[model samples]
Target: MTELLYLFDDSTECTASVLSCLPTGDGLYAVTLDRTIFHPQGGGQPSDIGTINNVSVVKVVHTPEAVLHLTDHEVAGEVVLKVNSEKRFLHSRLHSAGHIIGLVGDQLSWHATRGNHFPGEARVIFEPQDPASVKLVDCVQFQAQVNQIVTQAFARVLTENNGIRTVTWGNLPAYPCGGTHVKTLNEIGQVEIKKIKLKKGQITVSYALT
Candidate 1:
């Protein structure tokens, strides 16, 4: 297994040794490294795109055995692994925004059932205690509350026990997650709750960064 450098370091670039490089069809190669800063596509966040020795890394995936970097060209020996910083920053901001929205949902007595932090498709789905009680006005109020918290720029606290990582901000409920996030809520910038929709028993709150 590859050591995930991003877990411990904030830097988006790192030097690593190529452990194995194998062909996986379609003119692509599955490259493994001793350590990597590239975040694999998981937990609803997309993979980081950057270069390995100037070779484009098309995709990244985590397996039980190792973290694979899919590239168009083969690479070996020592390589400089770099992530597209712009994309990384956007992903972090959007993911942190989702968490804040989840906190707001808790305050409304709604339970978060799912979330997607992908840029342009970010949303949090919740199951309200009383589905009929949810309304657009309530969503607007919730958005205001979330923006207030973001303005406060609460620090994000991360802790792990028994291999389960929990993230918390101020008095908000701690949530178990493996995705990347900003160090503080203020980095999420202006959060706009685009819309709210009720489908069956699920209340979906769509959001965007302004």
Candidate 2:
């Protein structure tokens, strides 16, 4: 099993021993390391791209067995691992913003059904207990409330129980998650609600970072 270094601390770079380097078809190689600071693609967040022994990492994926680092070239022995700091910061901001949006949905009596934190496509889908109860005007109010909460700059906290990780912000409701996040909500910058759509029994809120 590969040790996920990012879960414990926010180290941007580390040197890890290469366990195996296998060709996964095409010209790509799947490199496995003893440990990694890379955050694999999961939990609605995209994989982190960086370098492994100077070879560019195209993607990172977590399997039941281990974490696989996809690279264009092969690597061996002790490799220097580094995560792209800019991409990591953007991803963390987008992901943490999504969680804040989820909390807002809870305040509206809606449960978050799904979410996407991919840069330009970031959004959260909520399922209201009663779809008819929400109105178009309510969406505007929701956006205002979320922005007020963001301005509060609540500190993001994380804890683990029985191997399950949970994320909570200030007095907001806590939720299970395994994604990277900023230390505080203010780091998320300004959140703009791009659009809101309510259909069937679901409400989709699309947002962007300013």
lDDT of 1 by residue, 109-141 (tens): 787888888999999999976776764336679
Deviation in angstroms for 66 in model 1?
2.2
lDDT of 2 by residue, 19-41 (tens): 99999998999999999999999
TM-score of each: 0.92, 0.94
Give the number of the best model, judged by TM-score. Answer: 2
Q: For this target, which candidate reaches the highest lDDT against the unseen true structure?
A: 2
Candidate 2 residue pairs in backbone clash: none
Model 1: CA > 4 A from native:
129-137
Candidate models: Cα lDDT each? 0.86, 0.87
- Superposed on all Cα atoms, model 2 deviates from the true structure by an RMSD in Å of 1.5
Model 1 global lDDT (CA atoms, 0 to 1): 0.86
